[model samples]
Target: MEKLQSPARDIHPDTRNGLHPVTLLNRNNLTLLDTGTSAEQFLQQKISNNIAQGHQDAFYVADLGDIKQKHWRFMKELPRVKPFYAVKCNSTNEVLQMLATLGTGFDCASMGEIDMVLRMGVPAADIVYANPCKQVSHIKYAAAHGVCKMTFDCEAELFKIAAFHPKAEMILRIATDDRDAWCALSSKYGALVEQCEDLLKTAKNLNIQVIGVSFHTGSGCKNTHSFCKAIEDARKVFEIGKKLGYQMRLLDIGGGFSGNSEFRPTFEEFADVIRQSLNQYFPNNKEVEIISEPGRYYVESAFTVALNIITKKEVYEKGADGNSRRKFSYILNDGVYGTFLDFYLVKEKQKLKPLLGKDFATEQELFPSNLWGPTCTNVDKLVNEFYLPELETGDWVIFPNMGAYSISMSTTFNGFPQPKVYFVLSKGDE
Candidate 1:
């Protein structure tokens, strides 16, 4: 119940803009511009105009206003569970600054992320070192930065923390049913429930304070029962800590919440499941504070990518029945080695559609085309087989729900330049 003091520092200058920075193009730059439609529409129009002007590069449109709406929804639906926006999801300075102003905390995996949040004027208490296994140097960094809350799943991590950050408050990360999680982290992180008591006992013996229990049901989890099971497991761990004379006041139901269009169980539906589980498990435990690390849920829907078609080719393929078929290959400016790494990491299929042209209605012939990235590697394929109207050179392809994982996981592989981000501000956002 005490107010945690933020370290004194100068406010981030960009925060004055109250949003992420973007190349705000006016009517002269993008004549098809109209603020009335959604950001996706604006991006599509912008990309189309750029292609006509001989611009063949990939870019992203981040709607800061839309991000604010997502934050608002989280506050409305899961009021009891405070969200520490997973910084790794989309650590754009604008996004981080915006979330910080909205009073959201951060879940940082590395010292660089923790440093970024701290330098942005966020309180140390608002940041959690959520990675269960950490380098000793990072532990020293967290300790030096006053980030006392951290997670550990093994005795070795405990010894490292106790040596480098003896005063740090620790959270035991237990494994969950991550089989149904999109990115199952239990294999790498989290201690077994049976081993949790021994971990807590080890912490007690080391004179280290075990203050909370944490578990991630994995990212993009499809099963709602996963939440119930994890929460129930956390309850058992809390009792273990209590019996050991430790005050386990924090419960970090680690991130696995999803917002992908392909992901089943909508955000609201997941929230319903989580809320019910929390009520059933921790209803009378008002003294305990509950928090979550939600990476994709906050940023996924706020991003749209506009990739230009670099080149295309048509090939005749013979079937086993002796029927010849026309197969089309379209190479894009961005691929798996770049901003679309999620395809390689999680096999997530991104939705792609061409810009609807004036002649699109008249030309109704569709072709089976494979989308590939502009890389030498053949594995840079995006869409395996998508039925769409024939696309010409310089045409634009629009991908939605790309705010999370895309930018953060992008690389400079094959010498392709990273896409420039353009922040689209809705009317009255200023």
Candidate 2:
């Protein structure tokens, strides 16, 4: 491996504090404040997320210091809407407690998750067991704990719940599409319109209370029109339930809110769509409740990942014509074995920038760099190709928009400990 060299010009002024690369890249670029100021500052100093100044929260924040004290603190003091933090996104105790404080509920996928939320002092009523595929043990656990509200998409699951938990409250998971979804979730879960009618009939026969219709347009949903389509689907389901003597009391528009994309629908616009859908579908029903499950939209910008550069190497690649392309590789102390497994396994795109100290000056020279995590396996690479200022051994790097899937998908592969997490609150002194 050869060393990749940096250019000779200085892009930024020299400073005394250590300069992480990210700060130098966006010293004056215009970007939204997704993480809030307190979080941005805290992350700038502690993690590698290269957060810019003047950023504020758009959704919710979870404190990481006390791993057992998960809570969701809303950025805006909005009224009339409750956030059901999707537990699958990151169910650390710290995250859960943070949400609990914000009066948010849990959208659980399994019995273990439900129990975890219950142990955290969140009442069973505040939980929506949203997993469409319910194991017998999970159903039994819900029944035993007096958690009667859950989701089902198929007749088999409805029958299982009816036989074991006859009084369970149920929601039919309906499939919908968004023309602008990064990852649509309809293939794995949710029932089609035709299937929804049969599932509702089964629910009625089993004496289950069908309270609502839920739809997930999928993750990274950018178009508000997709939400509108889902709302229309929910209306259809509601009408079918009405004909069967089942009163639909709730509408759960499931998670798919985008946090990383530069293009996103305004919350006001999203809220208006939901409001209009409700007004158009159930004009006389003021008792019907509208619920939304948003995970990435709330927490993706709240946290940052800080990693330390352990070693540097240069690799030379030979082209077909015998030309050579040189690159620099920086091995960091953390990788897929720690809090970034999703980045590797799922090939998820992550934003990388340098965490520059105040006194650090930016080097004008550009170098193609590959970031490797500190795992023994050859597969622990974080970023294959990235442009950065000249970085040497012991330099620290930061990645932003890492709050959603990073930690939740981490593993102890190669035996590396997970990175420490901290939450920064902006409210006046507690």
lDDT of 2 by residue, 1-430 (tens): 2222223222122322332221111212212222333444454443222323322111122323221122222223223346688988877555566667557788988988888888877888888999988889889999899887788888888788878888888999988875456666787788888887778877777788999988887777667677777878888898899999997888887876655545367555665776676677656556677666778766666566666677889889886899897778988877777667656655643344444322233445555788888888888887766766667765556565677777778786877767766554433221
Candidate 2 wrongly placed segments (more than 4 Å): 1-37, 43-80, 178-180, 261-263, 266-269, 318-325, 345-363, 428-430
Off by over 4 Å in 1: 1-37, 348-359, 427-430
Estimate, for each residue in 196-274, the C-alpha lDDT of model 1 and write its tens digit: 9899988998899889999999888888888899999999999989999999899999886776656787778888988
**Top model number, TM-score:** 1
Tell me the whole-model lDDT of each prediction, alpha carbons only. Answer: 0.79, 0.66
The local lDDT score (0 to 100) that residue 153 gets in candidate 2 is 87
Backbone clashes (count) for model 1: 0
